[model samples]
Target: MRDTVIYAHRGLNHAAPENTLAAFAAASRSGVTWIETDTDILADGTAVIMHDSRTDRTTNRSGSIYDLTTSDLDTIDAGSWFSGDFVGERVPTLRELVSFLGPHDLNLNLELKGNTQGRDRSIRLVETVLEELRRLRPGTRVLISSFSPLLLAEVHRRTDAYELAWLVDKGTIGEDWRSVMELCGATALHPSTAVVSNRCVVEEIRRAGFGVNVWTVNSVQEANKLVNWGCTGIITDIADQMVEAGRRR
Candidate 1:
């Protein structure tokens, strides 16, 4: 197997609170070189880390994360639902993330969450985040990705330095994949494991010179098999376990 990078999916989220300082700190301490996270804009235009539209599943509240201000979000217990020891965790902003990771040579695989309001909100939100990232750390090795092809394109167009990865799902390759990436000026591809189906596609994408990072793989056996198939990197919740699996053979 290649010496591919192992980035914690949402910052050791399977073990710690997802998108919180606790999660990121665990990933940093675990010796991970990079950590990936989902980002959304709150009501006060603060960029926060989270995967879903709402905090109900990961937090002790219901309704959309975007619907709340940063202070409002701080009030909700973000960690209790995961485990009692992790209770009272607050959602983290991109700035907080940069501060937490500044001491290490950690890369940020920031995912922009779209599918929001119809008011150019997605682009505006991304622009704000990009500005923050650029201001905090110039020439930072930040790789921004997104499931929305259009939004991904917008992010790439607006920024020239940040590496962009287009996240594609099953049955979306060739024209749709290349076209969107080309339009966005993306240098990488982040396809879901379900989409990359076999070794042929994996080799093909790599041979074509695009960075390939897969997502959310949990099982050791399944993860070991995927790495053997040759992805440039693996993003996993069970990171330490899967990385251990990769080393076993």
Candidate 2:
């Protein structure tokens, strides 16, 4: 079997606040070469790394990302809620993340959060992300993913420079994943673990010339199963343990 890649989900969120620079550093220290993070834009059009539309869950302050400016976001303490060791950890901008990952041989799976405002905003967000990435070191590998077909399709239409993946849940696009991939022109599939439970499904995705990267797989047993079934990668919170598991396999 080929070596199964382990992507630190939100940069080892269990060690530090999710999507924070501290968390990303922790993941890299644990020897994880691939990391996954979510993206959202601020009021001033600065692309920041955050999973939620609202900052209430992750920061010391409460407000929607769209309602907050880059200056406003910089003031929030994003790490205290997770632990005392990571107090005052600021949420990073996409440009900051690109610079941070540029020196390392890391592959970033950036999931573009949906823009419900309008198609123009969505296009702008994608453009902003690409611009930041361009400023980084050459040959940085990035895979863009989204549940928003509109945004993903817009990105695909705009640039063939980056690889795109269509994110799917079991309830939505479980059986019809191929159609979603085709719709978005995705080169890979980021499906919830529930959808890839059947080994044949993994084989099917591989046969169709797409990589299957399963998300949120935490247990060693589950990780081993996915790896044995020919999954390309496992996105997980426990990068250290998963790395050990991959080594054992």
Candidate 3:
């Protein structure tokens, strides 16, 4: 369960653009104990921090991130859309971010992009990412997750696995939820904000011996309700507030 600590979703995403260095640095300063982020490889096979296939929502541009080279990625304005003060912020590569934050002993949750077409590419990408982690001056507390089962399985088959989680948006629980998750050696269940339909879903996952962590929950009340139902932790936009709220009660 990685210490049952709070994970700042895309850093302090509610206060800054998601997946930007400034947002992550802000989250670190805000007293958050953990942070979670997304990772996708560029056209050149450079891993970049991003949450979308398109840069439309967070940056001042419209294009697939996968289409850009790492150098080309620097030309885009990732922060200006959030505010003028952040106009020239460049997109960060995954290894760059790891070097920036890895020393703080913060827990990290890495969501694999699942876009690589072949099993070899998927494993190679994850291998590269982990190799970077290994080079950190201080070891990292890391977890690898993916929406694609194939990618998840590739990661599982190849290396010294971290806690793998299945990232589901629609709560599909498709085919066989347990079967699918079990195949990847998943230790947690990450479903969307809307799937907190009943306490049972949370309880069920936990009862089956997996940690339950929900994503992007910001409201204190919304977060409190989930914590009250026994969630292990929450990945939230308002990291400090959510942690404080959880601690208050």
TM-score to true structure, per model: 0.91, 0.95, 0.90
**When superposed on Cα atoms, how far off is each prediction in RMSD?**
2.1, 1.5, 2.4
After aligning candidate 1 to the native by TM-score, how far in Å is the CA of 82 from where it should be? 1.0
Best by lDDT: 2
- Per-residue CA lDDT of candidate 1, range 74-184, in tens? 588889988888978987777788776777657789988875775567866887788778654554478888877778777766768778888777866555666667777
Per-residue CA lDDT of candidate 2, range 13-119, in tens? 89889998888888888888889999978878899999999889999988688888888866899989998988889989998899899676677999999876576
Order of quality (TM-score): 2, 1, 3
Clashing pairs in 2: none
Q: In model 2, which runs have C-alpha deviations exceeding 4 angstroms?
A: 174-176
Task: Per model, state how many residue pairs clash.
Answer: 0, 0, 0
Ranked by lDDT from best down, the candidates are 2, 1, 3
